[model samples]
Target: MLYIFDLGNVIVDIDFNRVLGAWSDLSRVPLASLKQSFTMGEAFCQHERGELTDEAFAEALCQQMALPLSYEQFSHGWQAIFVGLRPEVIAIMHRLREQGHRVVVLSNTNRLHTTFWPEEYPEIRGAADKIYLSQDLGMRKPEARIYQHVLQAEGFSPDETRFFDDNADNIAGAERLGIPGILVKDKTTVPDYFAKRLC
Candidate 1:
């Protein structure tokens, strides 16, 4: 069976609210207002798709709040969004690969985050047999076309592919395509999940 993993949240932990809270102090804007604009402006999506540079995105965000912020402060807040990978999750990936499974990463990430990916997970550069970055693919999760792209590129049948993602919508999309997918809740239970399915 082929295994596909989602990067953010599933592999790495992220807290947008934490960054937003910090930004709130700098922007003097209500948290609710900032969040509403962020979602409405699709700033997150733009950032993820590489449509907006980090400085440009931050400038937009600050302008939306009518607040002034230097790019450095914005970057500091943005960088605080991601937490590290859980060792158990990393171990699970390694174990699956050691067993000869075709393990790969299918992540939706912006250039800003990816610039620091190697430093964050140095072992991952050559570890995963294959990787699909959404920015480069011009596609993101919950999109059927991206799933098709992944399956086609890997030359794997949908039924034979097992995808693990943290987003329910993405998992649902994969399921609709005949790919078995599980929402990764706890990293420790992954071994059991894989064993039951692959055995």
Candidate 2:
């Protein structure tokens, strides 16, 4: 069976609050205001969809949030959102591979994250048979087309494939394609969940 996993939260620990706090400190923007203004706005969405260049996205974010930080500083804070890799999840992936299950990653992430995560978490580097990113595909999760795109491109049958993601909407999207999905809540519980099912 083809087992698809989401990157953030599912396999890697990410906290938007960490980025918000860092950016707030750097930009001198109040945390609440920063959180409110620097949302998944149009520019952010465009960046995730690979429509905006990295420089343009960074500049747009600075302008919108009235951030005084240079592009490099902003990028640094942006990439700091990821805390660490979930080792248990990596172990689960390894076991799944041993069982001859095809594994891959599907994430709604942008260039900044894509650039930093692999280097920061080498444990998952080359772990997946394929990695699908929203920036590269011009599509994001919770959208039916993205799931359909992966299913078609990888020649995975919907009924035979299983998807794991932290977002309910993304899970729903996979279900819409007739793919069974597991909504991952806590990273610590993932290994046990998969063990019971896949063992």
Top candidate, metric lDDT: 2
Write model 1 residue lDDT over 13-99, tens digit each, in one string. 777888787777876778788677665357767776667787888787778766567887777777777877766567777877888
In model 2, the runs with Cα more than 4 Å from the true position are none
lDDT of candidate 1? Answer: 0.78
CA shift at 49, candidate 2, in angstroms?
Answer: 1.3
Give candidate 1 regions above 4 Å deviation: 28-37, 188-192, 195-199
lDDT of 2 by residue, 64-132 (tens): 888888888898899979988888888888888888888889999898887888888887865788899
Worst 10 residues of 1 by lDDT: 190-199
RMSD of 1: 2.5
Taking all chains together, each candidate's TM-score versus the true structure is 0.86, 0.94
